[model samples]
Target: MCNNISFLGPKGTFTHEAAYILEGNLIPYCTIPAVMESVSNGECQFGVVPIENSIEGPVGLTLDSLAHKFDLKIFKEMVIPINQNLIVNPKTVMNDITDVYSHSQAIAQCQEFIRDNEIQPHYAVSTASAAKSILGDKTKAAIGNSKAAEIYGLEILKPNIQDLDNNETRFVVLSKNDHEPTGRDKTSIIFSIYEDKPGMLYKILGVFEKESINLTKIESRPSKKGLGKYLFFVDFYGHRKDKTVQNILNELDGLTYFLKVLGSYPEF
Candidate 1:
């Protein structure tokens, strides 16, 4: 029914952790697009996928899929602390580990440790999947959270191996509808310009400035239509239904080549 929620999985992935923010029968998918596709095709009522990581910037696949492939709304956001650990078979030790496996992002986050230990890096679809792969194999270790170690019956060879101590990831819940406006809310939108010009973008920002809306984030992604053409994604502190936000969007709609209100959800 509508209670089924999909997440990037084999369970124990960060997205899996974020999916717990909502109550549902959590279903696991192999990829972010798969999770989104499940929701788009009505196989699941909601899906949770990571939007960005503190250490490595945004998850481009999730943003690109949301911009192009899926017509989904972000229902909510959940932020989770990430502590990358070196997980190994119970019998394996640091010296026995010759190769490491994990999602590219995880590998990137723990590059320092990998380099210091002289372990060859291999990529897996997800950190949980990496943990699954190294089962019964002593030479290979996986970099992931502690939950993955527990789920895969592995041992934590080293804890908090990520380069940074304050690692976190922001995940979004995708569904057909956005959350109802809470007084404290945030709106995300994507837009493109008619032509590349200096003042054009400046004028768009001016609208928010004039309305006194606090802009939280602004990022650009290639529109993929042509060179120099890009899509601008903006997150601001207000609900789409709020009068001031509506004013800013109305003005933006008229100014840009096209504008899409991504969604409005309670600020996390």
Candidate 2:
């Protein structure tokens, strides 16, 4: 197993939380691209990247990076609960808050809070960077997490300010080797059909249905080879080693023109 892990951001971001869950040490990068590149180039033993958020849907860049550049496999999965806290300089008060700084996704996740408080949102590179920026300006406040507030020595003006109480983000740990099944596992794969004919997707899904396998998610992205072509990426709730999952894949192998099993990993 790999000890060193890298994630997106400097520190105090949700990605950092994922890295903490994995191994307690995180090498933070400025962007998801950087994180994936580091892992692809073997700069780190493993890399964690956000795949989806309960509020904002799938992270497009992460998905695209997985589809395009990385031959890396999913080693583990983690779900980090998001709790957006309003943080500001020690001297700043709630009334004096003018511009609110945060990463774009963080701002979107706290849309209701921002709207209710009439706080103008400004984008920063990351949540930790936002906190740093707020500390530099007395009038600026940040919508980040408690970790960020603590890291930057900013006071929490308000806590748990996210719109959804159960807000969480799912992250995937990437490496060159597949993880051994831990009973509770998930398999991810990408496939392209011969054609976009009617009932083609249903026909593909029927294989899993017949095997009684459960599907977790299904997303489609452009094949990027050219216009019109598309690829279907899917996550299912079973390890590849399981009999049911194996049967489903055997069925799918007969149907798909191109298919790749990304990995089978321990579920978060």
CA lDDT of each prediction against the hidden true structure: 0.91, 0.86
Q: What TM-score does candidate 2 get on C-alpha atoms? A: 0.92
Clashes of 1: 0
Can you write out model 2's per-residue Cα lDDT over 162-222, one digit (the tens) per residue? 8887799999988888899899899999898877576778899988888878889998888
Score every model by TM-score.
0.97, 0.92
- Residue by residue across 1-268, what tens digits does model 1's lDDT show? 5889999998999888788878989999988899999999999999999998887988889989998888999989888999999999998889999999999999999999999999999999899999999999999999998889999899998999999987999899999999998899999998998885668999999999999998888988888998888898899999999999989988998999978887999989
For residue 110, model 2's alpha carbon misses the true position, in angstroms, by: 1.6
Model 1, residue 70: distance off in Å is 1.5
Best by TM-score: 1
Show where candidate 2 strays beyond 4 Å.
225-229
Error of 2 at 124 (Å): 1.1
TM-score of 1: 0.97
